[model samples]
Target: MKIRTRLSLLFTLITAIILLLFATAIYYSAAKDREKEFYSLLKKEAYTKANLFFDADITQKTLQDIYKNNRKILNEVEVAIYDTRSNLLYHDAVDIDMVKETPEMLQSIHEKGEISFYQGDWQVIGVRYPFQNEYYLITATAYDEYGYTKLNNLLNSSILIFILAILVIFFTGIYFSKKTFDPVRDMIKKAKIISASRLDLRLPLKDNKDELAELTNTFNEMLTRLENSFEAQKLFVSNTSHELRTPLTRLLTELELSEKKQLTNDEYASLIHNLTTDVQQLIRLSNSLLDLARANYDRSKITFKTVRIDEILLDARHQVQKLNPQYKVNICFDMETEDDSDISIEGNEYLLQVAFANLFENGCKFSDNLQSQVVITNKEKKIQLTFSDSGIGISEKDLKKIFDPFFRGDNKYFTEGNGIGLSLTKKIIEIHNGSITAQSELNHGTTFIIELPI
Candidate 1:
């Protein structure tokens, strides 16, 4: 069953149970009041007969006259008088029904002094008086107290009415349930139509400030983000193919022209050298793409070998100095702990070297070769490598895109770059679970900062 249906049914069941209890209480209360009224009438009739006997004017003629005067109301009742010896004194026994004149009941009446009730096809309450040494039996007919057959019939009819009410309530509850849940169903249907293949489709939102409307808005926002990412991916692919193809086409054309024409040895050598440089740059581009793709997929497992932070920095500094002898390189080590500590991490060694190499290369490329410098700082849990140069600095906007694949910040310095070096470097650091950032002043200098966990 649906949730709303079950909720309605539960509500109805609770209401019905309460109603049934209330009906039973009311029925009994009405029955009790009716029974009291019947007994009151019987008592009143018994006292009247006692008054007649006390007045000593209860003659057969007077009794008959009094009975005729109240016959309309008293015909449904019975009046009887008896002696202490069980002998009837003044009673019209033939007028009473035979079913009500049972011998066992009569015996109890005699023993109990006054009859409270007399059983028959109809309900009656009886009372007795002991005035003037006489026994009196006064009974009044009552429908609420004794009419068992009629009571049973009324009960069956009431049960049928209750059952019919429940059925009506059940269908009404189901209808209300469906009506309430219709909007939610509509939202689900609309959501089914909006997917990656149909990003233009938007979910309909209502003006109401409810959770469903908020959900619709959130879904729309998610779809918008996915569409933007997909568009960026397409543009990236197109740009990358064009950039790589230009050099490849030029190399192929140059080799073909050289082969078809006679050329001097120096000319041929120059063509071969140019072709080799293009091939090497293409190979580097491919490798950088592979590295970036690997970063997108997974990082390497940590192999925590105890490494000296000072040694790593010194080695990087030496490598940079050898690459650019005209520039000055400075290394600083701040050892906050004793030796043999785990001043190392479980990481891919080769990836870390690539990151350091990128920082050094960026410094060389951007530095004016006079004040070019790289600083290495180390402590307990982290190492910070800074490379500062007095060359041209990056613009604020270009700083963010420098690490993007095939991104170029300098058109002049990029004469030898396929623009994948810094992208590969960032990917390598990320694989080592580290960070690299750039801070630069336009005219004075540029700085590259790297932080890696030990």
Candidate 2:
């Protein structure tokens, strides 16, 4: 069942139970009070009869006539009196023998002073009556016909009210439940029309400062993130396709030309060398593309361990120096801490090394003197590494997009690169939960700063 239906049924069931308990309590109290009142009236009638017969010197026939004339018609009261010897002295009913007063019954009334109990539909009250130094027992019984009729009517009315209350509670519960979940229904309807092409569509917020509004805002944020990711993926694919097509097209054209003619030895050797250069460029581009992809892939694929950022920088420096011996790469630790672990951070060692290598190579490649300076500082739970060089610094417009895939500054047109190094480096740093930033001015120098938590 739906939650709304369940809630409605539960509400109705609980209301019914409460109404039943209330009706039962009211009916019981009314019945008890009516019985007490009837018993009081019956006791008064018994006392009046005793006074008339014994104290007033009135005959039993005249007293019976007065009782029959003055008694309430609905209060079918009957009275009996007995002496201490259990001999009946007075009775006003034809069935007085049916209500036998045993010696135990009279002794009970004498001992307790007064007693009352139910005898089928009749309520009986017995009392000790003493007159002229003689002990007597008086018993009265009556049926509350009017009170019972009121009780039956109350019972029928209560049942009707209970049923009506249950129905009201059920429908009210359903109406409120639907009204409460109306936002969810609207969200579902809006979400159905949204596809990848319609990512710009956003769910409306109620601004009610409630959970439903919170849910709507959260879904809108998720859609925004998904849209950004989709756009980035599209851009990455487009750039990769363009970068790969250039080299592939060259390779195919050169191979087709070579197959069309047989040439002299020198010409053939030159053609082979040119083709080899293009093939090497393709290889480099392919490797760079793979690195970019690996850097941006799911972080779960990368293994993590505690690694010293200083040591990783040293390793990257050595690798860069080996690849370009003419370029100068220097490193230093610029912190007061003697503990080596202070400079340590958790990350994939190889990926960190690759990121630092790209930054170092970029510094060396762009500098006029092919020289770069490296500084490392360790602080509380963080390490700051800076790479500075006297290079052809980036322009303001190009610097903003320097880390974008396949983006190269205008001044670096002659540089031999696929332009994915900085992009891959950025992705790797981000994957390690670190940040990289750059400060540069055209023709002055460039500096790359990296921050990582230990």
Candidate 3:
């Protein structure tokens, strides 16, 4: 069943049960009150008859007349009077005795003074009366027609009201439940209209601070991340195609030119050297792209271990020097104590090495001295490393876009390097829960600072 219908039914069922119990209680209480009132009237009639029978001023005819007049007030009312010896003295009916006078009954009435009970449908009350030095027993019985009629009418009315109340509660539940889920319905409608081409669209937020509003906010935040990721993917594909096409085009042109002309050994060797350089450039670009893609993997799936930051730097330096022997990397310690734990951090060792290698290469590639200096420090429960190089520094405008993939500064056009290094380096550092930032000035060189939790 739909939520609205289920809620409505549940609401009606609960209200109906409560109404049933309440109506039953009211009817039972009213029936009890009516029975008590009828019994009271019977007891009063019995006492009056006994008193009048023993009165010396009232004659027998006058007593009968008084009883006949009062009997008309009660329905099916019967009165009987008896002496201590169980002899019937006065009977309300002329031709028959409605109540049987027994010795045990008179004895009971004398002992208890008064008692009330039911005889068939009649309410009976027996009373013990005292006249001059003698006790008499008097019993009266009556059927309360008016009381029963009123009780029956009340029961029927209560049933009718109970059914009406249940109906009201059922519809009221449906109305309120629909009102409550109206926002969710609107969200579903809006979401249906949003596709990849329309990622900029967002769900409208209400002014209230409720659960539905929080849900809308969370969805909007997710949409923002998805839009950013899509844009980044498009940019990455565009940049990759452009970077790859340059080296491939150069290689193709070189091969075409050599095939078209008869060249000397020196020309062939120079052409071969140029082709090798282009091939190497392509290989490096491909490796950098792979590293960048790997860095974007989910962190939870990656295995991390406690690896020393300084060791990663040393390994990166060795790798850089092995590839380009002319490049010089100097590592320095600026802290007071060289504690192993202080320099150790939880991270994927290979990714950390890649990040450091990129930074080292970047520092040396831009510097005139073909060298970079890396200083390590342990402070505030974190490992801080600074890579400094005395290069023909970056302009302020270029520095801002340095970490953007394939973004080379206008001043560094003469350098033979792809701009993937810094961007890949930043992604790797972030994967290890670390941060890297660069500071540079024109002709004053650049310094990259990295901080990682230990």
Candidate 4:
């Protein structure tokens, strides 16, 4: 079902339940009041008879007739007189069960010399009156026969009322639901229309500031992200095709010519090395791009454990030194203590080490023209690693694109990079709830700073 219909049904159901409770309370309350009034009337008449019955002159027939016929005109009430021996003295028409004064029944009698009792189908009110003579009077009225005959008729008529009320509430709910879901439905429909091809179109936003307004705002944000992702994917495909075509074309040309022309062993080795290097760079670029894509999704199973930041930094430094022995690579351990107690962090030790290594290696590659220096500082709240290079620094415009996937600087053609180094670094930092940034000046050095929460 549509959201509008479901919401309407929900609202209508809730309102109906509340109405049912209210109607039940009112119906029961009216029935009790009617029963109480009748019981009171019978009690008064019985007390009058006790005075006239003339226990002082029990031989009088006139008082007995008056007592027997008293309150007989009250069609809904049943009056009974009890003697001192707990026997039924006299009674008028009785429809429902007459309450008898057993020890349990007497225990329930109220302070007002009356008792009120209810079983689901019957409500009874009984009042007891005492006389100076050797007799007691009891009066009772059944709510079932009195008001409930008319009440049952009224309740049956309310069946029609219940149907009408439900119809009215259901229609009202549907009308409001339509009004509420109109703009949102429109936005969703528009969203379904747009894809990577039609990203320029945006959904309409309503003016109202209710929940629907917030919904439209959220939808707009989603569209913005989709548009950005679409653009990035397009750019990445274009860059990848362009980068891959160069090496493949060269490899093809070299192979074709080598078959046609005689070549020395050294020349053949040089060609093979160049081809291998290009292939390796392409593979690195592909892997980095995959990592970048994967990082955007949930990492719920990315388990973490206690890993020393200094060890991770040292590993990355040692690996970079092994790769480029030409440049001076220096790493110093400035830990407060070598014990795990003094320096510590919680993360996957392997991934954390890879991230540090990527940053350090990238610095070393860019600094192949000069000395490369790196420093890692472990603080109480977090760990900060700074990798500085003496090679060409990033220009003002290229600074922002440093972390963007496949973003290569204009002046760094001599250096080697797949352009996803900083991108992967940023994603790793984000996973650890950390941050990474780049600071560089032209002709001077570039320094990359990373901070990770402990």
Best by lDDT: 3
Model 1: per-residue Cα lDDT over 289-407, one tens digit each: 66556555544344435555556656766765675576465655444556445356555555555556556666666666645555656644666767777767787888788877667
Residue-by-residue lDDT tens digits, candidate 3, 1-454? 9877898898889889988999999999999999999988888877777766677577767776766787677565678888878887888775645556578877999899988888777788889888888888888887788999999999999988988888888889999989988898999999999999999999999998999999999999999999999988999999999999999999999999999999999999999999999999999999999998998899998899999888888999999999989999999999876468988999998999999998888888888898999999887998899999998888899989998988888765758777888999998889888899999988888999999998
Q: Each model's C-alpha lDDT?
A: 0.65, 0.84, 0.87, 0.69
Off by over 4 Å in 2: 1-58, 61-72, 82-88, 94-105, 129-136, 176-182, 263-303, 319-327
C-alpha TM-scores of all predictions = 0.56, 0.83, 0.79, 0.75
Span of 10 residues, lowest total lDDT, candidate 1:
138-147
Per-residue CA lDDT of model 2 for 336-452, tens digit only, reads 777878888889998888888888888888888898888998755778888899888989998899898888778657477778998899999899888889999989989988888
Q: Which pairs clash inside model 4? A: none
With candidate 2 superimposed using the best TM-score fit, by how many Å does residue 260's alpha carbon deviate from the native?
2.4
Candidate 4 lDDT by residue in tens digits, 335-391: 555567445777767667667777667666666464676676776667777778876
Lowest summed-lDDT stretch of 10 residues in model 3?
93-102
TM-score winner, 3 or 4: 3
Least well predicted 10-residue stretch by lDDT in candidate 2: 92-101
